[model samples]
Target: MKTALTELVGIRHPVVQTGMGWVAGPRLVSATAEAGGLGILASATMTYDELAAAIKEVKSRTSEPFGVNLRADAEDAARRVELLITEEVRVASFALAPKKDMIARLKDNNVLVVPSVGAARHAEKVAGWGADAVIVQGGEGGGHTGGVATTLLLPSVLDAVDIPVVAAGGFFDGRGLAAALAYGAAGVAMGTRFLLTRESTVPDEIKQAYLARDLNGTVVTRKVDGMPHRVLRTELVDALESAGPVSGLARAARNAAKFRKLTGLSWRSLATEGLRMKRGGDRTWSQVLMAANTPMLLRAGLVEGDRSAGVLASGQVVGLLDDLPAVGDLIETIVADATGILRRLASE
Candidate 1:
């Protein structure tokens, strides 16, 4: 399982448990790290103080190296970057492409920067900006995503970037991992796959719901905000889809205010972030305010165990997941299965 990712990040397996908001906490991160996989704590949903505490908590739980996924657009992104440098984290992962200056600062401190991208162009952008590695997720992934499927996106990114590329989106098993490697990827990154694992903090009832789904169970819609997000087709999702943009925006605004209050984001900071989102051309002011709503909405279903009012951000792979094994067991199973698959393919 040794590859550039494992060697660079000092993990035993090439598999990575990516940061999922309100899901990838210290317990899960430590568990993944202990199992020889790279575990990343999702800091996008956390306050600066919370992120700092979580980082320390992970360090106390496991001596193994793990990463922290941060929102590059957060106003305090610079402060968060300093916290990561101060903690000497093994790898710094970004939900979006970090600024060149931020990447330079981490590199200067001898930290590995691996930003997650949804397209080949983004992969090239981050790599050119001096990122040590990149995780390319395709359209089938959970949360914010692009339109290209993994089969097309992974190779496109691999061909475009010289740095190690970790393939994500619709990857859940050893066969998927093997396929990524065959496509010339360094390894595989997973979100929905790990979300259904025993290590995840998602509730049992919700996890069961995810397991019952099949490839056709999930749907991609812009109703979640304005971006094309893939999620399980629940009643709430259907409502949002049918409500049109006005109604959705109203709900999004309420959720945004709630999230702002919960996370202690000031109106000024919220407005500033909104402006950045607008300038990015990926979303509008209304959509930007609603962007903060997603984490809380997801938390309601994932953490509070309420699926009716909460939105569960998921990949199409959720339908394929049937069991919830311990993190250690899951990692070992993936490695063994991948090894067997690779060997069998070689024999053929």
Candidate 2:
């Protein structure tokens, strides 16, 4: 149960509840922290002011340390980092590798930077740039994910970096945690597993939709946000995959406007952020437009409880999950089970 991750973040267990947008909120986050695991508040879906309030809310709920997940490409990344520094947030996890200056600033403020990396090279890059640790998620992870399996990606990242690595994707129970530790990971970070918990703020109906699926129920498609987003294979996703580029762009534009109102960002600023997103890699204008689908589309299902209208991001591990447990019970059971598994393996 005690690993470098626990020591680094001052948590009792090496388990982490990932920052799932629209789901990882104050209640769930505080419960995870109170349960003795690292709970990450998803701030990418919130405005700067909202994030500040959320940090305060989490602090009010639990005295234990927690982290905030940030969007490295957000237009106000620097301002958000400043808030984390001022608020004395314990950990700052990024959806992408943050700029060297940002990483240094957070570390200078005594905040631990833990960027989630999909590839070994990214993990190496962040480690070299002074990240305290890395969460390496593989293809089986929910939402934006790469194509490698965790069994392969975890060791690759571990061998590539000296910093502690937390393995994510397809991890549900104690055996998975034991396997991760056996593979030399400091711990396991789970999204779908945590999202199904009783403390999750996701609506009951939507939670039922997620719980009803088997491993084959999820699909990774670029149609959602011009990225390989792994979501439940719902009719909406099927329509997206079959839709032409014109329809996709139309939906994107509409959602982009909605996002602007929700986040209080000016159109000019939103356009500028889109340009940055385009230049970040191979994202085209249409793909940039599709990016809007993530926040709004996710909000529909996770927050509004409209499963037919919104998308449910999930790990393939959904098939293996059955019931919802409180954050405390979930973490305690996994850690205790993992300890037993490890002991038995050693004795054998």
- Best model per lDDT: 2
Error of 2 at 182 (Å): 0.7
Q: For candidate 1, lDDT tens digit of each residue in 234-346?
A: 99988988886777778888888888877778889988887877997967666776777687788899889898988888898887788898989988888889989999989
Query: Candidate 1 at residue 315, lDDT?
Result: 91
Model 2 off-target regions past 4 Å?
none
RMSD of 2: 0.9
Q: All models: lDDT? A: 0.88, 0.93
Per-model TM against the reference = 0.97, 0.98
Model 2 Cα lDDT, one tens digit per residue, 1-348: 689999999999999999999999999999999999999999989988899999999999999999999988787889999999999999999988898999999999999999999998999899999999999998999999999999899999999999999999989899999999999999999999988989998999988998899879999999988889999999999999999999889988999999988988788887787898888889889998878778999999999999888988999999988899999999999999999999998999
How far residue 224's Cα lies from its native spot in candidate 1, in Å, is: 1.6
TM-score of structure candidate 2: 0.98
Estimate the TM-score for candidate 1: 0.97
Measured by TM-score, the strongest candidate is: 2
